[model samples]
Target: MASLKERITRLQSSALFRGMTRESLEPLAKILNEESHKAGTVLMDMNAPGDKVYIIEKGRVRVSRVTSYGEETTLQELTAGDIVGELAPLDGHMRSAKVTVTEDAVMFAVSGEEFEQLLKSNHDVSYNLLRELGDRLRRANDNIISRLEEQRVNIEGRMLRLHKLTEASKSINSTLDLDKLLTRILEAATSSLDADRGTVYLVDDIKKELWSKVLQGSNMAEIRLPIGKGIAGVVAETGETINIPDVYQDKRFNRDFDKKTGYRTRSMLCMPMKNKDGKIIGVFQLLNRTDGAFTKDDEEFIDALSAHASVAVENARVAQEMVQNERLSAIGRMASTIIHDIKNPMSTLRVYAQVMKRKSGNEEAGKLADEMIHQVDRFVNMTQEILDFTKGVSSLNIVDLEFGEIMNSVLDFIQQDLEKHNVKLLRETQFKGMVKMDQDKMVRVFYNIASNARDAMPNGGSLTVRTNEAKGYVNIEFVDSGTGMPDEVKKRIFEPFMTYGKKHGTGLGMAIVKKVVDDHKGRIEIDSEMGKGTTIRILLPAA
Candidate 1:
């Protein structure tokens, strides 16, 4: 058993009671009741009224509850620096859990009446205990509420999926066109599953391969994958839903992909994409579910999502085939017209050149004829560009493209024009990365933007071109210190018929720029202030 002086010393040592003035706890010290109990003695029982609370001075006590079946569950074991029975006194309720002596224990007990008397005299101690009790209750309640909210959110998500699937089914049944159907399917799959990124991979069962057919995401730039690899491969081989909460931690996750692109794989939920006959046609993988792991609810939702997607993909394929046939017919007609137009002009130019060579009398006439021929050639090139732009003929021919090298070529191509216009070209080529793209198409995208900058700064202000790496993408910035466009002009700058200056300009340059960016699966952002300058920012995926 602890002596009165020893009990006082123990209480004084605790951080909770040490801050009180000596005068404030004088009554508590003088009236402190020291009691000793053997091990296994019940100090406080469950359902008992709370009249007194105990502060352990020495040894230990087990606070526990006995169930109806006589099983004991220990709530807490009280040792030195421990207080029990505060919960009930603070709430004016019965003791909730039993406190028993687990070891020979010495304690100081304070009755409710004495505690009230102490509180009336020592307001600081009373207020401090009240605050601590209140904080504990509030924290417990907050934890309960947070868990309830999570459950409610999960339930609501399931209901929303059912509603979305109903609408998606109706839309899928009504669509037969392949491109439009694919767009709808991807949009639905992305939304219904609540995934940050969703992709449809067509499986060639014979070849045992998976190829990305369609993808959608807020941050999605481009898709590059081969079959029999990674999470998608797991789905393909097992024909089961593979829910990988952390792909990076999974031993089966192929890091070869991360090596290829500088992007890391996080979470993935992959399921087999099947057709109407329940035949596995491909694998569908969704990455980084926005909320958490693809829960049971998500799996159900994705099952429905995949059902609609599979049908739409097949229908779209058929529709696309038909569209291709029609496109070929139209191209054949356009080719004939182009041949006639091109050959007739070339024949006349050849005849004129021969006449000039044979006659050799009028030098000015010959010079004028030669200049006219050159103009005709330029017109032909411009016509071809217009044809390519209007037809949306993206170059499928891929090459290892060094971005800095191509940017240098573009800068060189526009250097002479910049000199003619007295524009100071500034190049900040900090990026040294590569991409798989068509060289011609990439050059065209840059050329269009740079040329527009030159035209904007005709009076010889500086034009700045910069390149750098961004969040999983490469960014190129083109800034021109020109008489910037007004809000009205800037609003329509990318339109096919919008031109800021030069009466003879075709106004298709920016429009073509937009097309090239779309072809590269990239984004363009334009920022301009009237009378300040304009900046065009382009973001493309890095290889």
Candidate 2:
């Protein structure tokens, strides 16, 4: 057995008894009892009332919590010279975590009441305890802040990647040219992903091979590989996105291309481009990320990029087909016009020739000759009109002419056509002033509008033409009580070859009117509703 003085020395050496003087420790030495726990012994149960404080003097002990799933999670391991159960005595509460003996252990145990009395009697002991508790609280707060900062960084990275993907979609969708569209797609992929090099391989279904159109860093001849030969080909065949940290280690990676080009390949990411119908169309591959190996995030980003590129490729192909169709249509319309215009003249010529042959001996033969001459004149005039229209309005005989008189002449020229369609015309002019213009071109503008109105009101409708002179400008408006245009047609009304609801229409009338207006430095405005009426307003600078 140890002597009283020896026991007192051991007590003062403990962490809990630190800073206590010999006089203060004398009472604790007598009250503290030496206790031993066998290995695998439970010293205290969590949530149980604890009235004693234990200071470990030998061996190791584990502190742990039992989870809701009934599994033990070790909170900490404490060895000799450490203190446990001290917090419970200070707050007079139950144990927070269960304490178990991992090995045979010895501890100094003191009742809660005795420890409280000792703290009150010694100011140094109380001060030391407060300092230790403060340190533990600070460490816990630092751990919490570290976890929150990590979460915030992850969120910011996701948002930045999403923004880049959205911008890439917009850039590729803006163009219909195949060359420019493919170039932009490759540029966007390499830059956004921080790739050192990239290439886009489109699958040629007819040839049953993969062909590259755009490859970064070198202008090589088109690369063609069989459908199952290389890594990119595999991705195209399988419709899978692959990320390889070490391209050399993969057996499927082809090294012959690298040797031929004198380029070293490192990391690789290959993704399949699929159309909206979910059919694989191409493969996009990137090599050697600038920072490190490509991760799961890079795979997700590239997958989204490939989706947009697929749609853009399809759109460009469709637009090209439409352009080809328009060219063929223009050729057909030109041939038809030439044949239609010359047919009536040819018919009149045949009729007069037959009459002249049969009436050769008649008294009225001279009168018939005069009629044939008149018909020849009409044929020449028809050919000249067609030639003028095809030549466009190049020579503008610009001169000062009364605005009201020009309007009257345009109305009279289209009067017979208006009567044939049963359309009424109303004219209102507030200006009789002379305006600088090419009379022939201005008359053509009025003729086109009147013809359009007449066609719109097949049964019958009123047409109104109004002119007004304002400060330094003149305004002419054509309003018609005819079937109006839909929003889609109205938006593209001035584009050449855009027409609706007319069988014999060439769709060039408004386009020509716009050209004339622009040459004179003027503006045109249109207002219409589907079921309501249509209005066209033109503004010209005053002479």
Candidate 3:
């Protein structure tokens, strides 16, 4: 046992006595009773009385609470020079958490009444205790902030991963080329999971093997493995995700490939890609992860991404086949139509040339020459329309032109055709402001509409062309008093390969008009009845 003087020295060294004067600590130290507790001893129980405060002199103590399941969860650990039971003494409440001696410990215990009296009598002792309590509160606040920061970081990481996966899916789905699609999928998978390299192996069901379609890190030729041969093969065969932290330790991992490629294998993540029918299409194999081994979260993310990849692969395969078949069909139809249409004009031109050669300087020779010129013009127009339809609207020569001027130019170009068809023309204008548009394309739009109107009226009818400005848009309307169209014909009028009643019609006129309007960010509305007439309205943004 130590002397009272030694006990006084120990008390003065404690955190609660940090700022106390020598005179203030001497009397408190003499009244404190020295206590000893062996390891595993319970110092206090929860909801117990608040009678004394204990300051640890040596050894460790654990503060814990019993959960509803009867399991003890440690809140904190205290060592020498720390104090417990101080909160109970200050508030006169039962112990909030139980304290136990984790190691054989000696402590100085002081009664609550005697401790309060000492604090009241000594101003230095009171200030020291208050300061110690404030320090504990700051430490508690710091712990809470640390925990919140960790949670925030975890949530942000999860959000970023989800965003990357979504973007990868979109990119993979956009391409129809199998090789390009596979490359993009592998790149996205390895990068999202922080893997060094990756490979996409598609299963060859007919051959009972798996073949690599895309390998990220190596320039080696395509590698083929039998089903159930390697890690990837096993996943493809069983349709399970395998995350191996050490590739060498796993019996499923094949070492021959590593030896041939001169690349040391460390870790691997292999998963099977399944289509909507639940049939495995391919296997995604990721090499060693950059940060560490792949986790459960990585497995879940890869599984979701693989589902999208499987659908994309199947779609690309089907789309490629469809495109090839369409190309062949289009080529056959275009060749046959061109040969049949041009043969008549060619025959007519050849006959007119022979007649001109024989009847030189005759009155009928001039008339025959004019007719020949007309036939050539018709043939050129037919060919030009076909070329325009195939080229598509890729670039536009945009300019600001007055709406009234554009309408006048279009009407003048088609006035002769209207007269030839005996169709009366009616023009109406409300505004003459300039509109930002592609001039040539806009002219083609009006030309196609006017030509369609001429074909509709074989006998004679009225053709109304009007322009107005309203709601910040320039509206152009072409209403014709000719044989109109039915509801079904009007509905599909703007679709390619749809024509109601016309000979030598490629069925691309209205489709081209709609494409031009859409490219200019404009709208087109058509209203037609079987006998009443047709009204085609175009709205373009006013400049």
What TM-score, computed on C-alpha atoms, does each candidate reach?
0.35, 0.42, 0.43
Candidate 1, residues 153-191, lDDT tens digits: the string is: 987877787889988877776788644555566667778
Residue by residue across 205-289, what tens digits does model 3's lDDT show?
8888887654435632456788887788889889988999999998867798789989987989999999999999899999999
Poorest 10 consecutive residues of model 1 by lDDT? 213-222
User: Higher lDDT: candidate 1 or 2?
Assistant: 2
Q: By the TM-score metric, which is better: model 1 or model 3?
A: 3
Runs of candidate 1 exceeding 4 Å displacement:
1-166, 173-229, 233-240, 244-249, 252-268, 275-282, 286-307, 317-332, 341-346, 361-543
Candidate 2 per-residue lDDT over residues 208-257, each given as its tens digit: 79876544456434567788768888998899888999899998888997
Cα deviation of 302 in candidate 1 (Å)? 4.2
- As for lDDT, the candidate ahead, 2 or 3, is 3
Best by lDDT: 3
Each model's Cα RMSD: 18.9, 22.6, 22.2
Which stretches of candidate 3 lie above 4 Å from their native place?
1-13, 18-78, 92-125, 141-152, 175-181, 202-210, 215-222, 226-228, 234-254, 271-283, 291-300, 310-543
Question: Ranking under TM-score, best-scoring first?
Answer: 3, 2, 1
lDDT of each: 0.73, 0.79, 0.82
